[model samples]
Target: MLKIFKKYYGYQWLAAFMLGLVLPFIGKLLSVSGLHKVIWFYLIINGLYTLYLGYSVRKRGLSPLILFALPAVFSGISTLLLHLVSHQYGFYFGLMYIVLSLFTFFGDTRDDPDENQIPVENGFRDLKSETKNDGQVSVDGNLKV
Candidate 1:
């Protein structure tokens, strides 16, 4: 699994780089600034997030730090390259991106107990469960259909 992820991880990098390349072009077209520019950047960042998220769901990939970090760096450079935002604005933009992406990624993930697994106090015991779709969970960890 690690090998598979290592092989495909480049895809995440490539997407971020491509996003950087494309964003300046899109900015040129829309000429967005002020609140709109922030919204635009946010949307783009989250769009990249979905790419990282897809891989994560399969348990076949690693962190979104690639998506978060690369795009922030590239977007900062892009502001320099394309003169999209002033230096001060660009700085804040990059900082916001890093903070927001990290928060977004970490905030959304969870390590809760599996809904299908029942809690056991003792060592082990035989148990059976049936469900009829009543949206309730029995003590032995079975769905009510």
Candidate 2:
């Protein structure tokens, strides 16, 4: 479960978005209003998630570009779904979430520093040794933790 969480560490808000979509239908079975009161709850949860995402990305020295357009695209899809279903079900929350996500992501403008890329090697050998110009395998002298 933690592995899944780490793999999708930044996409937890999409779960909230999906739950918001399902809430109206779930309410019908529970004898509750079909999402009339849940919009605020949805926004609050996603807003908190957005705040954490913003803060963590800043602290981790990540590129804003990595987060750029992610919330926009998801919120855009949510907004489009809202347009399709809101009139039929009568709850509108997508616009405000989009605005909040836009504010959080757009305010971060720091460029990512250049990443040091490790050269890829494909071989059955367990040791990390590169072939020298003289066609002899030599161990990499540099050790990294």
Candidate 3:
């Protein structure tokens, strides 16, 4: 499951964002107290997780600074907004999660293998040894193979 965990690290961020965005509503529906505390805890955990992933990718020469920064900033802003806005904006928060997810997906380049590392032999190959220089092979006399 570790492989799945690594692959969906971005999704984890989305889920955390969703949880933080909805917890207050859920708590209100259930008449539960301390919703803010729960949401804050969730945001804190997810924010730290994002930072960890960013650090890991950065260590591998992929700059995940923006990925980390945006979420960290959003977490603070959204938490504050959730408190100030009486009307729940969970849907908008979800939209923000999707936007963040897209950014994370597009921003990451570590998932792709280096093009320079691909072996030449594994690329286009000539059927005949003589025409290897031309990158095309000639057949029989009339066929120009």
What are the Cα lDDT values of the candidates?
A: 0.57, 0.47, 0.48
Cα miss at 2, model 1 (Å)?
A: 15
Candidate 3 per-residue C-alpha lDDT over 8-93 given as tens digits, one digit per residue, 9 for 90 to 100 = 56554565455455544455566654555345533444444554545455445444443543344335545466552232443344
Of candidates 3 and 2, the better by TM-score: 2
What's the best-to-worst order under lDDT? 1, 3, 2
TM-scores for all candidates: the values are 0.50, 0.38, 0.34
Best by the TM-score measure: 1
Off by over 4 Å in 2: 1-5, 8-14, 34-39, 54-85, 88-92, 106-145
lDDT of model 1 at residue 34?
57
RMSD, candidate 3, Å: 9.9
**Model 2: pairs clashing at backbone N, Cα or C within 3 Å:** none
Worst 10 residues of 3 by lDDT: 84-93
